[model samples]
Target: MMSRRQIALAAFISPLLLSTSASFGADIYPSRPIKIIVPIAAGGANDATARALALDLQKKLGVPVIIDNRPGGNFVIGTGAAASAPPDGYTLGWALSAALSLNPLLYDSLPYKPNDVEYIAAISKSYQVIAVPGNAKANTLKEWIAEVKKSDGPAAIGVSSFGGTVHLMAEDLGDRAGFRVEPVVFRGEAPASVDLAAGQLPAMSGILANLLEYHRVGRVKILAISSESRLPLIPDVPTFIELGYPISAVYWNGVFAPKGTPKSIVARLSEAIREIVETPEFRARLAAIPDVNYINGSSDVMKALVKADQDYYGRIITKRKISLKN
Candidate 1:
């Protein structure tokens, strides 16, 4: 409705206004405390990793990074919570690869899609280990396989949850090792380990970090780990690959925000996380844990990792017909 000169002036001011708004958004990104939702119970590996990350991020961002545990429904409950949260970058979820990758194939429906969240960065990758009570007769992988073959009933293997990486690893081990072992699902690792220690279950597979303390106490014996090479934390323990079993799967943990979060905000948070992960203190702490490694990559890299695993697990689940529910 104005003259050409007035219209041009308005156009010039529009870009300036947008630039100012972007700067303000970036500057005030975490004006309030951030909430990091962990889709697992407290005292589990995911919860432990989230708390460790929160501590580092809190120091880096100069704001409290609160951890909210929403454990159940194969990570659907917490993932849904994060997906429905406002996309201001203040509410992020620590997504496990199993939940983001394997759940689609195991369940018929999910509350949120993988694309509903923006991948920030992967914090850590942990290898799975097969362990037994310290007093078990089978002291080695070969011995355990022999015992399972000889057993009349399927060898009971305890797992933290159904449709998780631990569950998939157990299934794959049974398939590749030519043995029959029935997976016994537990609510969490603590209870599973308790039953294993009590000799109720012959063996169990889970993240090495969760079993490290028990292994140190000589209460459990680690047969083999699902890593390409020996873990520095437990150098004596051999990898599944080294034992002639070509099973290698690393459980990764990373940060994600609800989709539609600004690219600028995602970039800022990713950079912050990357910096924290690369620090000497962070590396030293994570390195001390068995079979746990640090992973820092771009958003695109993270997205590709999630997609590839999702596809891989999809094929495995469909082909093997592994179902969590009877």
Candidate 2:
């Protein structure tokens, strides 16, 4: 026969204890600092975007956000670390299109599977562009094709990374436009541009950021962009679609947590990111990067996005027999 007061107290405390169980997810998420893992070396687009997002998230969450660069093994080490991290929201990482969609098809063994992570939000996107040196005789994509048909040696195209989406785009371009390209991988876009500027590399197709400076300085000339419509920034740069060759693919940057991250916490983070991306300041700041679009999506949408890219890129890689065998 318990007293009424004791019964009421027991009922009240039971739920409180259940809700605050330390073994479960965070009671008030971001109670501590958060670490975001970037899969690439610092100074590139992914790293820049990660730092920007960290700054925005810190302002919104009121907690210190740190970027951890884990660049190695073709993004496997960093991304795998994120996937195996505790399901708490503290550990998140860059969900690159290359890693999510192409790695599984490219590599023999990955530490974590695609389902091992939950995508939080898509932060940015970039479009591919095809370009050549300013002094090159080929003024248009048609003229460039004509030159390729007459070329003698391997038709080399510099790519930021080997076996990435850029590599596939180059391959797909060659397949669709009827030319052969030997993808020459450099440490990154900067070094590749050095070769292109010096005329060591003939033509390159990659995310626009890599070639923007080169194009501006007349070191490299952009012939076409892979967008359905002409971009306001470069109205003169025609799209490949209108030229009778269409490559409709957009490379996006995404945020992902280890699978099983609490839905409530994920929702909060996603909402914060979605709001930040909508800000005008964010847009103006990212404009320097080129062809970047912000995407807001639910976990299901993110999952579907990953699946669609996997399927789209998978077909190209399979037909071309592109594999890392790592």
Candidate 3:
């Protein structure tokens, strides 16, 4: 119904109009539910943190936020799934230290690389502690090291997972103290804490939260914490640094999106998370989880933290020649 010149102009304008519409669509992110893939089993500390964040994020974004637990493969399964997802900002991930730093250092190949997912914002960090059975002879970390040195064989230490902060720190401790550590991998820290409490396990390093109750009741003796200084909850428990060990088992959990996610969306989400984490209500909720501290780190901060972890753990893994593949 139009002239040739008019038809040509109409075609040119249609593409621009569609492009503008697409941009508008992106601006209204979370028009639907946003799913955050948590790379750990439900009911764990990471899962709890993810759920807490999701609930607040849902409220802030005016949309439903869901958590998808895709546990196993040392976070590869869920993290790979997140990496392969469409970069539309609807699908994201809750990533921990192993996914971002430790896995790459330990594995020769992975379904997802460090660059596969973009770090959005860091949510929280959990600290670890070295503990032994309540009735163990060694009371101090130095005494424990001495006892291990006297052992005829490798000392058995329970670890929640391989290629994790706990495993590497325990290995580093043994490496420095001139003893071999036999890491008995458990499904999670809960079961390992149970064994340690029952004296079925000789010693173990676990998150301070998992061991706090046990330590309080005398089921386990927390030798040292990974914090820079003593925690108010357990002020008497000294830090590894205080004991002359350069090991720290602190690990962070953060939000991550696919690599190609739009920068605007990344910034928006990061800002929202930082705002939520700084709230008094959120801080109170976080405090309920022992040993967990709210960091509220932005994307740049997360990148730096990830890099620092990679550099620190890389040296330890390379020096020890540790391979999770084995």
RMSD of each: 3.4, 3.5, 1.3
Report the number of clashing residue pairs per model. Answer: 0, 0, 0
TM-score of each: 0.89, 0.91, 0.97
Model 1, range 47-98, lDDT digits (tens) per residue? 7667888999999888999999998888888888998799989899988898
Candidates sorted by TM-score, descending order? Answer: 3, 2, 1
lDDT of 3 by residue, 175-243 (tens): 877888788999999999999999999999789889999999999999998888888989989999999
Candidate 3 or 1, higher TM-score: 3
Off by over 4 Å in 2: 1-19, 23-25
Root mean square deviation (Cα) for candidate 1: 3.4
Model 3: residues with Cα > 4 Å off, grouped in runs: 1-6
Pull out the clashing pairs in model 2.
Answer: none
Query: Which has the better TM-score: candidate 1, or candidate 2?
Result: 2
Compared with the true structure, all predictions reach lDDT values of 0.83, 0.83, 0.89
The Cα error of candidate 3 at residue 167, in Å, is: 0.4
> Which candidate leads in TM-score?
3
* Candidate topping lDDT: 3
